[model samples]
Target: MNQTQKIQNPETNVPKTPQMNERDFVNDQLTTEKYMTASYNIALNEASNQNLYQDLATIFKETQDCQRNLYNLMFKNGWYALEQAEKQKIDQTYQQFTGYKTQLPYNVQ
Candidate 1:
């Protein structure tokens, strides 16, 4: 039960050099897009002008999408990895969240 399982693709080898590799480039871009989206979220929250808010909102959506794309690409190339959650843990979490459904406004049950 203590065994760890990871979900990942076959890793692509890269020369460990001073220059950045494909994974590094994609990761950097993903990080940048994440930062941009966060900043846009803050700006949108405090934006006084409707037009400016709309424009920023559009750009935020685009940046968020770009981040997802980069993340997908990284995962495909084995640069990104994720742990596989145990079924018991997942079921417990699901039950916990389901217990909160009654607290919702409507009948989301």
Candidate 2:
């Protein structure tokens, strides 16, 4: 059957989808991870107890791992695109930051 005929057929076995697809779901989770990571950082900073801070820190690392995994999956699926920065640009940034080193009170020498 032609492509149009398959789409037009009401008896087609195509599964009904919600407003959001798998990509959208992953994107939503990615956004949630950002907020969750931020919240964890804030809580960890405000935590006065060492044990509580350690627990929050552990959870924060897990959240970061989850975010990284999701990013890798999205990149593999072509849902995410990352542009490579030129070496010249990276060198320029490095030089800019390194220039501030002399401004410190103590000398490296």
Candidate 3:
């Protein structure tokens, strides 16, 4: 079908579901709020515990360091890939311009 027809009759075969009742929706929202409040209280309690918080902080710092190292490695790898691609493009340009029979030496060795 063309774009206009498809847009006008998009997903015509799909069945529409019934909407939720107001009472049920309100009850779901209240339950979600209660759970969130409980979770906050638990987090506050954990934070107040000095030993637990100290251990958590150490673990968080280690995790942060690990993530930083991973990011650095990935960034270096991406840079290396881009450098290789640029070198390839330059080599192709040089070969086209000079009519070289073989690729130019990339290194001294």
Candidate 4:
């Protein structure tokens, strides 16, 4: 089985010129969303006012969801290339995390 399988749909046609294209625009939006999510996360952590925190939290969720949707759209159009992780690697990661689970305040077992 090929472990480096790329999950993507047929790429949409776009003009190849110095000007911005559809893919470029969507990619830019994705980048912006990524930055926004990071900023929101920081703000959420530092927020002191309960009402402001709640409002920011809600907006953060919305922004995060929008970021996901944009990423999906880009993937659907083959704008984003993602490689599948191997099962062995995934299992190793899971095992490592499970080992660290013991450090939690509660028992996970």
Candidate 5:
């Protein structure tokens, strides 16, 4: 069967299937998780209460783990393709960022 092909609904003409719907749902979940983790990090930094910071930190770790699991699952299923950057490009980026440290008056520990 051509599972990859999309078929339109006769009534509303909305093209979708079980597999595609699930894939979309997973993708949405992954995106939501990413946004949530970023928000958690920001909130944690701004948090004044120790208890609140601890709670947010815990949730952040869990969210990060969940995101990693989702990424692994998607990669395993061929749903996600991660392209590898060239070593030269990576080295160039590293050098560029490293040079920014010298430009700043404040030293980064």
Candidate 6:
């Protein structure tokens, strides 16, 4: 069938979504707020804990990896959001940076 016929007979092909009621919307909002509050508290507690720093560090590293993968996928497939030159510049800068390290300078006797 042609595009117009397909559009008119969408019920046979496309799935139907249920409409949300006021009570359902309120409940969803309440659940979202509850989770958000819990997450915020967890973050606050972790921020204050020394052991949690390590866990946070690991999470941060993983998040960075995920972001890099997404960037590569978006740009490599000609679906890049930014200009190619800008993307290349960012890639070069990231490559040039080394991770943080601690080293004390030698003291004269």
lDDT of each: 0.91, 0.78, 0.49, 0.94, 0.77, 0.49
Pitting candidate 3 against candidate 5, the one with the higher TM-score is 5
lDDT of 1 by residue, 1-109 (tens): 7566999999888879999988788899999989999999999999999999999999989999999999999999899999988889999999999989978989883
Q: Residue 101 of candidate 2: its Cα lDDT?
A: 81
Candidate 3's clash total is: 0
Candidate 5, which ten residues in sequence have the lowest lDDT sum?
5-14
Q: Model 2, 1-109: lDDT tens per residue? A: 2222111212212224777777778889998998999999999989999999999999999998998899777776666765656667779998997888878888765
For residues 33-82, write the lDDT of model 5, one tens digit per residue.
Answer: 89999999999999999999999999999999999888766665556765
RMSD of each: 2.0, 11.1, 19.1, 1.7, 9.5, 14.0
- Candidate 6 structure quality by residue, lDDT tens digits, 1-109: 2222111211112223587744344445545555555565567466967778677666655555555665454444433334234555667776665221222254323
How high is the lDDT of residue 40 in model 3?
49
Which parts of model 4 have CA positions greater than 4 angstroms off? Answer: 1-3
TM-score of each: 0.83, 0.76, 0.31, 0.90, 0.74, 0.35
On a 0 to 1 TM-score scale, where does candidate 6 land against the true structure? 0.35
Clashing pairs in 6: none
Error of 3 at 102 (Å): 65
Q: 27-99 in candidate 3: lDDT tens per residue? A: 4554555555555445545697788777666655555555455444434433212223355566889779675
Residue pair clashes in candidate 5: none
Q: List where candidate 5 sits over 4 angstroms from the true fold.
A: 1-20, 106-109
RMSD, model 3, all Cα superposed?
19.1
Kindly give the stretch of ten consecutive residues in candidate 1 with the minimal lDDT sum: 100-109
Segments in model 1 whose C-alpha atoms lie over 4 Å from true places: 103-109
